[model samples]
Target: MKTFEARLKPLMIAGLDGEAQAWRAFLQLLRPALHAYFNRRQFQGDADVEDLVQDALLAIHAKRETWRRADPVTSWCFTIARYKLIDHLRKSGRAKLVPLVDDHVLLNDGVEDGAVRQDLAKLLEATPPRQRRLIEDVKLSGYSLAEAGERLGMTEGAAKVSLHRAMKTLMKRVADREH
Candidate 1:
């Protein structure tokens, strides 16, 4: 009996060579492995696991030309599966990375704190005075939108729009700085 890798290698090679039947068979063979792969990682449910598997298979098919014959097919397939799993986690809003240190500890570090403050000040400076005040009151000061709006003498809806525009401007500035 052939090992799973051995069984998959020929099919992958054939699939890459444009054999439609071989590609279909390769995907079929990969389904169970993909399911098991996702299950072991504690995917939300069977449905989620199946969805991830199907996504992985489709990605594998689409990116087939990028796979090198010199590499083990299993490694290539699992790499795609891992990427799909990560994407699913991100899309589902479950990809947060917990910090090792507490917020208090981070704040006390004092390293580059001044620089960070200066950078933020510069970013905030790019916005108009009213939008900047709204962001500071609502986002930095942790006030509710309604409270911020009342404090700024504007309706909550107007405050929200101003904050959104301010945030968009700040994001563009940050992206520009990075480049």
Candidate 2:
């Protein structure tokens, strides 16, 4: 392990000159400690803590101007790295804290709405032009069948029949593809 003064002096001076070599030296000094810090504290599967450490070091390098030269380098480096680790924990869904409750409440939420919309878009791709137009007018755009009938120049019953048949055909096609 590199001694604190040996590790810090070069970086502090090189950082003054905004030299990349100083940035590299600083990261090498900090990485091992940051790794051990994360490993000892956070659970595994938090997206490779070493990567987070490197990210923190890079961020420190990028934001090096913010540091006061009078400040001790180790404290400044660890503080930045600690904040980065906390940020990673929050983003990775590992930092949430909820109150304990006696009553268990569960909701049966189905597939995500975004996923359903994507499936609908895919279904529309395979739909015939008339069916696609009718679905857009009635289901999607919220047009009444009577209005749709007038637009298609067909009777209300004929419009309903065509729309129903088109929906059934689409369902069958989607079902067949799934199977």
Question: Global lDDT of each model?
Answer: 0.74, 0.64
Cα lDDT tens digits for candidate 1, 9-80:
899999889898998999998888788767767766799998998898889889999988976677678767
Number of clashes recorded per candidate: 0, 0
Clashing residue pairs in candidate 1, if any? none
**lDDT at position 139, candidate 2:** 71
Q: How close is candidate 2 to the true structure, as a TM-score?
A: 0.46
Q: Once superposed on the true structure, which residue ranges of model 2 sit more than 4 Å away at CA?
A: 1-6, 96-179
Per-model TM-score versus the true fold? 0.52, 0.46
The top-ranked prediction according to TM-score is: 1
Q: 47-159, model 2: which lDDT tens digit per residue?
A: 66777877877887787788777655665665576567657656777743321110111122111222234456677888887778887788766799988877888888988
